[model samples]
Target: MKLTLDFYTRPQCNLCDEAYHLLQLFQDDWGFELSVRDISTNDTWTEEYGLRIPVLKYKDLLIDEGQFDLDIIRKRLHDLSSEN
Candidate 1:
């Protein structure tokens, strides 16, 4: 089963841009489907993540937020892959 990575972000966010670039770089290596969600388009999403743009989630599990930590996400992905 391919994992779906949900990226919650909004426009004009520098951190989101950086996180997105990193996610793109990791996409091929991790083999996960990327789903970009513009929080501004959804009220619920905006409310939940208004202060937490650039959030990364694998299913319901949050991988990272804000500036994003590559090492933490990498470890989580490694662990998740091992479980499959």
Candidate 2:
């Protein structure tokens, strides 16, 4: 199964940088393709997630704003693994 991390980001956003850095730590371990969507150039994404530069999305679920919990992410990944 391919897990997509829908990263909604703008140019030079510090939080986006930090979030991507954190996500990189587990990229190899998780073994999933990383897709970056620049909301700056995309109107729909920009309008929906304008101020929320860094957002984590998986399937139909969106992680709550201000909630980048690694433990929770780990658990979700583990669950996904078991499902596979």
Best by TM-score: 1
Local accuracy by lDDT, each model: 0.90, 0.74
Best by lDDT: 1
In candidate 2 the C-alpha lDDT for residue 5 amounts to 69
TM value for model 2? 0.80
TM-score of decoy 1: 0.93
Which residue runs does candidate 2 get wrong by more than 4 Å?
64-67
Candidate 1 lDDT over 1-84, as tens digits, reads 767889999999999998899889988888787899999999999999999898999888999999888899989888888888
Q: What is candidate 2's local distance difference test score?
A: 0.74
Give the backbone clash total of model 1: 0
lDDT of 2 by residue, 5-59 (tens): 6767778888888878888888878755568889988889889888876887766
